[model samples]
Target: MASNFSRQEPWNLSQENLQEWFQDNVEEGSRSFAVESNKSMDDLVRFLHNMPDMKTKGPKAKPVKVKEVRKGGSIEKGTFYKDGSDLDCVVVLNGIPKLKANTKTGKYRRGHLKPLVEKVVTALQQASFTARCEKVSNLQLKVYAKQETGGILEIDILFTGNNLDYNYIDDEVTMQRILSTPYNTMLNMPPKSQRFIYQPCLTPLQTEFVKSQPGNVKSLIRLVKYWKAEYLHQRQTEKLINSYTLELITIYVYEEEMGSPDRFDLGEGFKRVLSLLAYKLGGFQHYWDNFYSDETAQRGMKLKDMMKRPILLDPADPSDNVLQRWKKGLGTISEIARETLQTPLLRSIHVN
Candidate 1:
């Protein structure tokens, strides 16, 4: 969807006018794209479920058992963008023990899951799907399946032990352990392997946090995401902010500005989000006690020294500081946000 603001045109639009434009453009576009994307996702999930058990070869080769496959990320949370949209599929494997960090070094052996990843990719190709695997980072291994409809489905196949269950959030001990860990170790070997190994288990909580918001709040999220996409376009070298971080920031802006009101000015919230990004991002710190207690967060912050600037902790997994990797690009992001805030459409809106 196209933004209403332009660089050259200075339009003196009211808050109501901005909201109307957002509804007509941003909200409507998101709904239309979601409808089409959901259908494709349903088909993809069905295909994944029906596939036979895949096997890997080595000295200890065995049939890779499938426990369940989950849908996560924007498509699941309903904050998906039309351009460059993709699904996050977490394939949970049974009988595969979670990899443990070396006690001596306190770091996991890198590429431990390479054998399993290769096996999954082979299975996808055998099923007539064009699949490619890439190790995006030491913590992330992803598989991209090219669709006949020209869209790609990004799958994160996780090998986890039986100990980490879906009800982990209910376990107080688990939550405390997750919260108290230092950021460096957490970044390397995330608690319960939430970011790398057992991320699928945390997907439900992450999805519910955003999905449970009001319609307008979700729309605000979509608006911010669209703005982020447009701003970051053609700037691949910059460490672009992830969609989850943007979603949380949007929610935080709305909650801070409008409280619990069911409805508010969408444009006003958008402007404040830009204002925060442009001016207040360097010292940003946001967390939610939806899954863990605030007391736990406070203690954890003190223990982990996580009170550092730009801490955007994952609500589902406290160990994950979502903004940790994007420190280098904050200046660029702040500059773009400032420019967007000064654009003709947003500049006229009074933020108080």
Candidate 2:
């Protein structure tokens, strides 16, 4: 529940807006994984090892499987891409800061990991590795890669985070300050050089939200990335342009389809989410349970397609501006927490 979100518009990363967005966007469904084929994933793996951290024996972790997208009211269980579709590999990292590449003193980029994207492009230019750096977030970096000839290959290195710090507490027996022993690491640390990083914790509901692909997945993905981008620095995460669009999409879901609680975990993380959750907040259950059913979406949230509209860029007609244009988006209601018969109160969910 240690969340840092705002409610004011221009939609920066605010907890108030995040909550409402989830309610509006997420569909009631569950999601799991069934893999097939992917191209960029391989390159992403190679890219992971190429990072300075791995090169210098820093903490390198394995990539886990998440759910897929949705189809005609069904979860699409398959590889990330099929045929000659482009692919991209990724290495989701933790304990890294979203500080700009120039910030000279952070654990993740001590000038080593900092120049990675640039260096990769340089390497690719020489050795035929086609890649591009797309978006970078607080804890995640989405890099794009593709075949130069006729294919697609884009991998996103989602740098999920856990607090990695070098806090030194005192050892009573030793009568001296000692380093804290952290968990969930594949690398060993010395007392003087302990690592420190920030990790997020999501509720059962929230975790379901992450995997809820198209549903809160897309919206949550925006929250995850946008917050890091806008806030991790001097500003806030919500300030990003995409953040507002994401928030708008969220409101659309909740106001539209308030699905049952359990159904939220339906298909798998991605498929179920994409199919049911995103922009379909009509069916979220305020309570808890597992598994799902069509009956769930019956009593969904209040969602409506608001993004499709006409607009003009006139300052005189403030509504003509980009911000005002979204302000006109239907279902712009923003909420923080909700109350139900169970008196079940809600709190912000943050996970890495």
Candidate 3:
């Protein structure tokens, strides 16, 4: 039977459709700053203000505010359904540093960042919860945990020191500088795309994963754009948006296998991110249930040891279900997903 998919309101990629997508999803009782983020901007602000290092006006101290950027953009939702879903959020910053590049290394390295994050980690510790802060993405520390109020929050505390020179009141100058910053400088990926990369956002990591396989980024981008649009169209419940995003990342990261020693040789912490995101998300089951390709499931459970999870997938035809269809048609989807799935886990999932 031919697919009976109908391109509807939230699933359309046209501007009109995007407006509606934003209206239906974002404008109508949206808790964006809440859902997309694990933590609160306000909490982040307060924590920083209390930082012992930033408390005084000395040779190396600066203050920052919650830099909120609430705007609209589209999401990858695909087929008859591309996507038009937009997003809005407050991009808050803790402390903006005032570091001028040294004559040698240009931008200061770890030596400059340690003091800043250490103070950040210390203040976050006082939150009356079990929180830990560690350097993860570039200059950002992945700090997170559950608080006393039973709220789960994760944050990317960045030590940009990018725009801390409060001496200027000129918006144009500041905006210009902010724009010129390096791509990897402080979870840097916004100000343009309709889709936010950090959250439901397609990332460089995902882009890299896709590079090795079938469909081009445009096609894959379209698929993800529609996933959020259509999924939101169906369910607008709590955290559904975030869930969709995580699923998007999961799908994008799916790969074949990860036993290769070359895994560590990938660009810029690619190996670590592959392992961390996979395990943190949901282990093998995360990819299996959410992003699993029929091939993985069909890796031959009939082999006794391997075939334990036979491929219920229509071996002859892979493109069936939308998600499944993507998996089969676009080999890259599974390739990335497998790399993410087969990460070296501290504890491999068991099926007893």
Please provide the root mean square deviation of candidate 3 (C-alpha atoms, Å): 18.5
Model 3: residues >4 Å from true position, as ranges?
A: 1-9, 12-22, 32-39, 54-102, 129-132, 145-151, 162-352
Per-model TM-score on C-alpha atoms: 0.79, 0.30, 0.33
Q: What ranking of all candidate models by lDDT puts the best one first?
A: 1, 3, 2
User: For candidate 1, what's the RMSD?
Assistant: 4.8
Candidate 3 C-alpha lDDT tens digits along 10-39? 322332234344445544423343343323
Better-scoring candidate (lDDT), 1 or 2? 1
Model 2 weakest 10-residue run by lDDT: 336-345
Q: Pick the winner on TM-score between candidates 1 and 3.
A: 1
Candidate 2 per-residue lDDT over residues 72-140, each given as its tens digit: 001121111121111222233343433321233345544334444444444443434444554454333
Per-candidate clashes, comma-separated: 0, 98, 27
| Of 1 and 3, the candidate ranking higher by lDDT | 1
lDDT (Cα atoms) of all candidates against the true structure: 0.63, 0.29, 0.33
- Write candidate 1's Cα lDDT for 1-352 as tens digits: 1244453222345455776766676677767767766665565567667767765455665666667767777878877777534457666666554543422222322223455565555555555444666665433456665665676666554443332454435565565455443323344542344344444456767887888788788877887877776655534445477788888888888787568577777777888888888899887777888766676555445434334678877787665677776777778888778767766678677766
